[model samples]
Target chain A: MRLAALLMLMMAAAATPAAAHAFLERAVPPVGSELATPPGQIVLTFTEGVEPLFSTIEVRDAHGSVPTGKPRLPPDNARQLVIDLPSLPGGEYTVIWHATSVDTHRTEGSYRFTVH
Target chain B: MSDIEIAAAVLRSVHVAALASLFGTLLFMAVALPVGSGTAQVRRSMRRLVLISGLAGLIAGLAWLTVQSAAIAGADSVAMALHVVPTVALRTQFGHWMLLRLFLLVVALFLMRRPGVAIQIALAGVALAVQPLLGHAGAIGGAAGAQLIASEALHLLAAGAWLGGLLPLFLAVGCLSHEMAAATCRGFTPIGLASVLLLAGTAVMQIATLMGGLPGLFGTGYGHVALLKLGLFVVLLSLAVLNRLVLTDRLAATASTRPHMRVSIAAEMVLGALVVVAAAFLASRTPGTHEQPVWPFAWRLDLGVFSDTASWAEPTIALGATAIGLAIAVAGVIWHRIRWPALGMFAAIEIVAIPHLDVLFVAAYPTSFFTSPTEFAATAIAHGARLFAADCAVCHGVEARGDGPAARSLPLPPADLTANHFRAHNDGELYWFISHGFTAPDGETAMAGFSGVLSSEAIWHLIDYLRAHNAGIAMRRTGSWPQPLPMPQFDAQCSGGRIIDLDDLRGRAALIVAVSGDEQVEPRSFDNIGAAVVVVARGIAATPTGATCIASEPQVWTALAIVLGVSLDALAGTQVLVDQDGWMRAAWRPGDAEDWTDPNTLAARLRDIQSHPIAVNMTGAQVHHH
Candidate 1:
């Protein structure tokens, strides 16, 4: 119970205020990690709330796919941004993002992740 | 010598000679020769010489301009001449001044025979003043530039009064009657003395400014020529003094003195002409005052093709010879016998030793080669920006503020490209650093080498981009616009709730400002962009509310100028450009503002800002295709 509470407290603290610049805290399937199976969605947790209007998440493999739907923010966590992915075959993939924090500071980054 | 150099030298010498002749003839008429010399033939001949010299000077000036234009174009070919001549004439300060001089010369030519000769004299003075614009004085701008030009103008005028007058004075002595010749020679003594003093004072200033230090007086080719000119000038001055104090009375008292005095004056004229030629050569060579030597000269005891190490060959021998020569000269003088040869040998040894000292210093501490760009263009910076994005941005960060994502993973934090530590390095040192990647004190490579991946030209381009950014002239990739592209128009609010339309500021220069959320405008930003500044923000009140702040609706961002498809959000930390005619010129990421604070640079930018043409994109018109 204590460990659970500590983890919860840490997550809350990690969720930065909307006024601060939003930087990537962590990502689903991990950046530069080889996954045995493909993930259904890529979740990016930022240091602050990222505005959905100007922000983007693009994923490309050997070929390319038009990502569907706007990035969704969880009701419980505004700092966590979720982009749903379609089922994919095994290939090397690159994830590119343009993130605009609630305060309107924009930052972009790219990383490569693999799915076997 | 190379063909261009030889051509340039010849043209410069002829121009100087002709200019000197014209100036000297006029001065001789005014100062030395009285109104009535009872000899119409002598006066008519002098007048004819003046006319001839003026025409020759004009021709030589034109030829010098052509050669200078070709030299700047880096080719003597007819093909390049067509393009370069127009640019040099229309764009350069030197070109503007030269045209002004040519116009003045024409005016002077028309006014030459008239009683209003003062105007012609004034025009000639102005023409001489502009000559320094072709030399080092013009290369370095600002207060230093002004100082150099002033000193050089005075120096040239004094030289014209003295050296230019010598030939005409020589002729007067030969042709005039005994009484008139003595009177002319006596009358010139004071004028000559004043001009010599002026020349001495101005020469000191020119030498100090152009020769980095005393050491530079020996180290550079320019310095060697200058010393040679100085030595000749000393000899000329001695002859002038001899004539003024001793020979003047001889011309009045004895007929025998005429031949000796005339010969002496002729010698002075020749020496003076040589000095002018040396001055021309000095201007062609780059002064060592501001630049480091490319390579230290190595001396060998035994003359050979190359000497990597300093050898005790010539310098030691020269030193011994000079000491012995000086001793012999002193002994001969004591014995009431002057050894002219020994004195001459001493002077030669002293002059030779100057270069040897420079060689020793260079061989002792040689620096890496620095290849500075002869031209810095917007296109070069754009290419550099693209390369930087591909190669360096991943590590140095997008804005090169050194906050790239990979920066966290490095053992040592990547250097902040925008920091003073990097910008402070000379071009050669920077090149060396980039070619050979950084290493830690513990001998571990901090950054990977890009030498194998990129060519030298690419590396230089990267430096240009970084240098431009650091210089506050940000380079951007692309902004695709439709032909007759509608100007991205919007209203902005300042800090104090004042709304300004984009069209309202169109008639004059203005900086459409952009800053990140909560980012305050520093005092320097205001200092750098002294013109009107309009800040962009969303809604009624923005985070940075100030007197100059402008608030617009969030959807108004669609009307904002963009670069590389970067949205208004991404443009937050960048600088936006709205030219004078309401055209969206550029949206660039600015580097540090401090670099552009140089007065000379600011003055240049001010000129650019005033003259920069508005971008007019037409339908199917030229657009930046990234």
Candidate 2:
């Protein structure tokens, strides 16, 4: 009953216009996952409408050198980007993404994934 | 339209229709559903009215869908009409909600076939519940959004009700008895008054959204259009008030004056429809809610071939840029989650500063291969050649000629690298190989641990070069290979920490070592004879060291030059000052020079400050007291 009261209090707090824009709830590959082979594309699902033009997502190797298709955009103008790697050897790869929503608010993020 | 744009347009258009359809159906139902009780003539007239109004609603929805795509996504006619109609039937995404709305409408229409006003009202109410979800309510999902959405939705419904109610009023006076007309006027007057209030409230909300407040009222397209919308509605409201106050009062006493009041109401309805059209246009515009760019970038592309990617290879961040980016990301996330949008927005804008950081850091390391997407492909093949040697050449022939003596014992066929079929495939297919294996991700898996062991990026690069090699393509890199050039070897040494001349230790082979602040050797060690010239860099030290302490590093390099019997000035074609922290680095360039060789001058200056306080003291030589 005590826990329920706290929950009720939380639920009663309304979402403000500003609070609606949330950062990524969960990034794919669950932040860090070692894959057998490279995935063809990089997908980012945001809490709001992301602007297609001004956003950039890049994949870099351990050496900090961006791959051939480092800062790639979405293939079909979708919210995801597909980076063509010249060759991604087995190593820890860092995916860095920066996006501005249609609302014109900018945000950036980074996550790591390794190739098995 | 490009595929994505086409998709977004189709989506926006169908949704507009779905939203507008609620008002379309409701207005017709309001006008056509009612008739006087216990009369067969009234029932027949009501059915005819129902058929006409329902048909009008259908026509309005079709027209709305046609214009909607053009409004929201700029989709041209025939194709758009074809696209949106089919989309509604598919019931996807926003379309799903529209379909659910349509289902409710069908149920309401079926229930209306059997006429109990209570039953019909219940079904219509249920249908209206789906109306908000058909969209236009999102503007209300958040508190502010809700206020705006509620005002807008009411504006739409109220306008429809006033216009719809007028149709019944006109028909009752023209075709029905005088008693029915009197009853209709009473119902119409209250409904019309309620609509005027809703329209006024909606106008206020739109102005709030577009102009934000007082100052913006005179600025922006949204502001201008809103002002215009408000002006028109004010005129319409005034006409409605005049009809209700003076004209409707006279309608009962003098039947001939009825036309004037009805004309005023019709004019108001026309103006209200114009407002609806403008409001629809406003909805299509970007939310324009936040001052910042909601989404930073508009384009995200991944061509399985990383080669064609925009801004791919070179990252444009500086040394301190990564830290700043990480800091911004963290701070922005924290601020956003905490409901501090203003602070979060500020931190988020720092992303612009971060990309520049990458550009600066990328400049520090030189490229291992030429950066050309096309030219470096041969290099990729060479890289693949190396990769093959490391991973595949054991059972396959070194030349890939298909005759490895050990291949006969293997269950899988050795890779036929020379096969035109394999070489001709796209990067996507080659990736399929690395992803699946030697058995072919297309075939089976055995493929070895190449995919498991090597990064896909390396494998892709290997394939790129291999493809070029297979294509028999060659590109000449003017400087990809090492080219010999003659440049000065400024490795010089100082005698007693002073600039020692090259001629002074000519026979002694004075290796003139240019001492930078960072050098590895002591001043005395340069007195040996070695084949290579030893140059000490004095000025290269990290911090500001006095010349006296720094001069020692060059002195030692000079001694080594004398011992080697080779003039530091005459060492070789290239004076290689630094061999990039490699094995040859310590041998070629050595010693630390962070300290100063000319400390006496500094010491005198310090003494002048400490002892004399404010006065400048002269040194012993400069004073020259006899």
Candidate 3:
């Protein structure tokens, strides 16, 4: 019975959910979204806290890449990253992000959202 | 593997082997060998071995650090890595641990010649214990992490005591008198046995934590390496058993067997070295559970058979026959006179049982157990829906019910993808059918493969879309979902510069309104009834007034429409009530009578949901019948 309990404990520990690396959890202008008006900035949130110094967010359109400000973590949430965008005409835009978590595991993804 | 990774693994193996040998030799001299049993020559040789292993460990530890620095710096050459070594050593946790290990080794080396065996063993043991802190075990947190780390430390110590002591034992057998040699072998047996038991137990714990279970063990690179290590370990154990049971007795009785015993010991040492190398390789690879498993077999046992009463008869008969056959064989073995008759009866029983057991098997593929690379989120589902329209709608139909425009053209009707039978196939099996296409038993092509047209990520998105589409159909037909679907998450601008998403409303019931911006409903009224309200406007200009949180994105309409199994126009004025766990519990359409807009009706629904919170399977994967 003791051996059975220890085996149960080990199995339970193995089943515990632990995030191995940073993943794109959610975004303000969500992936594949379309808007009636262009937004002033882009915000990206990850499943784990990320280092803003090593992380980056790049926005581009059909013409070429657009200039954006440096990515910064919000004061309240370390997992939230915000980047300011200049006023622009409406078109489909792609947002690419690279995140390095505190443990130094890195992940990158890209998605497109349209502005009418 | 890259050049830097290979270098690191090699250095790590050398470092661990050297340190284990040093610690193990000291331990054997202090505890296992009888006091005053070693002669001058034996004592001098033992001292030399300790000094050499200590120096080798120090050098290997430094080289390991250099390779790690190169990998972290992304340096192309040794010189560049050397330049950044100082930075890594000072700035990183890995570097700090390595420095501490080196300090411990240095102190142990200084005390090597002194008559302080206990101090030397303690210092070396501490240095070796620091190893797991630099590997995958260090990255984990919480109670499980602590358990993993502790098991790993004990595992290392046990390995050191056993594998590390092999060389010293070989040395003693070669040099000692016949009586002395026999005595030394007797002395080592208890220590070796204890170490082996400890090693095996700790290893099981580590495998449970790192490999997950049998599927992970058979389906990943890290697991393959671990299997290789286990193979080596078994051989080492067999040799150890041979020495203890056969060779030790012969050596005790006759002087002639000493040479033979030395040869066997040498083989054990070689196998032990191979085990260490395999462990080093495993440490460099990702843990098995984190990767997608490519199942190698074509058949898998589905315990799901037991869950269906109709399917239980065959397996039950198979198990009963096998059990009876085994009992008869055991009785025959004890009786001896009826052995041949019992053997014949057992064989006949097994032949009858085997076919019945076939019902438990299911057809599987190389990708049969693969998980989705993309998350089961709303965005991926929406993206998948678009892909399905462009590629799959011709034969599968817009609703995937096997009644498409091209259904009459195929030799076999397309499969109904939204049926309950669809849930039987796992994600990887579906991925295989989609990428490789389906073929009828008569050799006709039922569907063409989409590998040439759709990228792998696009295929995953398509699968996510199918899952959501199936859930929507189930909900519409049954008036409740067979399983809860997570609310498709969306972010919206809220008051006070604070952003809110559907996730933020968790821990309370939420009423998500898909409005046309023309509704007279007051959003704050739902809040008074103890539910958070989120308004999803059809268009940016259609933003509803007096709403603190609004999702005005256009894609939000299309995504939620897919879940509601409705068109964009039909999506307006739809409301879904989500439980505290973020699962969509109930949905109301625009034309439904006695709708949730009434406060009392909404309150009653909220009370029902709160009283019976769902035990959600967060991954949203289909559970097997068993």
Candidate 4:
């Protein structure tokens, strides 16, 4: 029953509004949430389907240097960009994403998540 | 004229005249020249002319081959010119036919010098027949191509008979006695008349196939030369008529009349030669079909009633003329007086009218993206949204409901984007509006045109967005989203190395659903239920603790959209229920009147799905046991 209520709330939120820009909606680590273990890949979902060819998301260490494999967009989700991260020591990491949606409209944002 | 042009013209004329001479000589010796004391002398004279003409034609054909090779290679070196002969002869249709004709002409010449008249005639006919294979008729495909080639061959033969035989006829008229002259004229009249008729009919067919229509008979250099040739032919026809009806009679009646007859006959021969020269000029230019840049896209006012500006004008004129011609033909038949001439006139009119009618139609209604619009896709809406947001959203609201922040300062509010007014006009008109921008009748600019800014494709995307938005509004208003039931098994890859194969979950009911785009679901809703729950999460796949979560598959999304009976636009927010045994039971969407939010109703629907065992048809809900 509590889960049902949550479903209703999420459905209501989805129905309330939609936007054209590729704003970062959520991430696998849930945007700034600390994880017990670092994820193999960092996934960033957007407001709209982003064109992977023109779009990029880079994971950088605290020093602002790339610390991951090339960003790959899984075909299952056009709106999300997934990049494989190398094994990392416990520290704060930043994801910098610049998305060009299928419409060629460009949007950029950055979010930080920590690994224990 | 350029050197190439001049050479081509000269070679073409020489080749055509020589071929015509060969054809005409054979025809005159067979049909017109009387068998008598002068037959040997006449035969020797004809044989000399035929041999000369055949040799000249072969030389000209070889020269043509070399010149064509040089032109094709874009080189002028003697080596390349010489190289072209075999290349053309081996590669091109024209070269092949020319080679064949040249070879056959050689054999015919050999046969002509001997006593084998029938074989010589057959060889000459074969040489002429090979000619159409060198020209436009050779390029045609299918049954029409065969027909055109046949028609062109006949046309060439008729041309050779009528024009090539002229010199021989004139020579006989001058040298033979008045009695022989009169006899020769009478003998040649029927053959000339038949050849002329054949020539005219075949000319009409070649004109239709090569020129496309009457419009092709104008504007282009080819058209001009053809018109000149056509004029010469008319004069030749008139001369033939005059000679047959008047001059032939005079040849027998008076000595003075014989001189006039000879002079008239000479003039006819000269005109016939000029016509052949004109034909040579015509051949040097591109055929109407291949003359793309010069293909006359002409349209003119028809009978002061129809204009080419109207798309329907050409068809209306053609159909109307045919109807009138047919009516007149039938009337003439019933009256029994003017039927034959009426029928002839109808044929003449069609020959003149039909080919150019298509040209007029094409000119009137040219094809473009505007003429045939592409259907809109969801991606188009996304692209259009971006453009609309960047450009129009300042004046038109973000939602395009038209109350943008900038709209307050304007004299007129921006047009309501959600309104159904856009549905009234066609996509092309809408495109034009976007390109040129909305302009008031009073000459005030409302929305600035994006023609210089956004491409036509971008504008189309904008139009697609508007259309999709309008459809969404209509769907919302209808209070029913038709999502079909009876879900089928499909494949999906899940997060914990688990493949959520729907077919494998047959005996156990599964709540197979997708949470994609903006939609989110309570992942733990199936925690207490006995049924299995698999979430095909697209985008963010943060499932509740107990639920099996899979990354969405393309097939799963497609199958979800279909089985759920939801438009792809609404599929992102839909949930599908598969009954025990893998048959899709039901689907639910947001904004549906059903109380899906209530746990009791959700439980009841799942129980109902379980109770109705066996294969249950979704539409009729008829349960049948295997």
Output the number of the DockQ-best candidate.
3
- lDDT of all predictions: 0.62, 0.44, 0.78, 0.64
**Interface DockQ per candidate:** 0.01, 0.03, 0.19, 0.02
What CAPRI-style quality would you assign to candidate 1?
incorrect
lDDT, candidate 1, B1-626, per-residue tens: 45776677778777877776777677777777766837566777777877887788889888877776666555558678655766666555556777787777777777767874556667766776677765656544446667777888888878887877877777788888867788888878766888899998877666666764333444566667787988999999999989988898888887778899999999998888888888887776656553443433332111221243456565556546656666877776676556676666667756664455333222211223344431233334556777888988888898787888788877678888766455545454556567777777787777876778888777766776666554331223323222112234344544433335554565655555554456665322332444455665532244334335453444333234222244556656454545565544544454644334343553445447658764443211112111
Kindly report the fnat of each predicted structure, to 2 decimals.
Answer: 0.00, 0.00, 0.07, 0.00
Task: List candidate 1 segments past 4 Å from native.
Answer: A1-116, B37-39, B79-87, B293-626
- Native contact fraction (fnat) of model 4: 0.00
Top candidate on TM-score is 3
Lowest summed lDDT across 10 adjacent residues in model 1 chain B is found at B617-626
Please provide, for model 2 over A2-113, each residue's C-alpha lDDT reduced to its tens digit, 9 standing for 90 to 100.
2232233233222122212314433444355555566655666554444444457787886785754543445554334444555567888887877644333346788888
Ranking by TM-score: 3, 4, 1, 2
Off by over 4 Å in 3: A1-116, B39-44, B113-116, B142-144, B178-183, B186-209, B320-349, B492-494, B497-509, B524-533, B540-549, B590-595, B598-626
Higher TM-score: candidate 1 or 3?
3
| iRMSD value for model 1 | 28.0
| Residues B1-626 of candidate 2: C-alpha lDDT, one tens digit per residue | 24433343344433333333334334434544344563346445554554454344344444544443332333466677566554443422234444554465465556556755455444443433344333334412345555655665576566655654554445454554444444556656666777778866665555445343322333345445566767787787787678667765677566776677567667765675666555544443333222221121122111222243564344323324444645656676676664465455445655554444232111111111112221122233445656766766666676454557677666576777555555434343455465445564455544454667777657765554344333321111221112111111121223332332222232222222344343443333322221122444433542212221222233333322322223445322112221211011111222323222333432332233233222212121111000
Q: Which ten residues in a row have the lowest lDDT in candidate 2 chain B?
A: B361-370
Counting clashing residue pairs in each candidate, in order, gives 20, 115, 0, 7
lDDT of candidate 3 over B39-121, digit per residue (tens): 55676787888899899999999998898777766679889989978876776556778889999999999997688799999
Ranking by lDDT: 3, 4, 1, 2
DockQ computed for model 4 against the true two-chain complex using alpha carbons = 0.02
Model 2 stretches with alpha carbons more than 4 Å out: A1-116, B1-47, B59-92, B119-151, B177-180, B209-211, B215-217, B287-626
Please report, as a residue range, the 10-residue window in candidate 3 chain B with the lowest summed lDDT. B617-626
What overall lDDT, based on C-alpha atoms, would model 1 receive against the true structure? Answer: 0.62
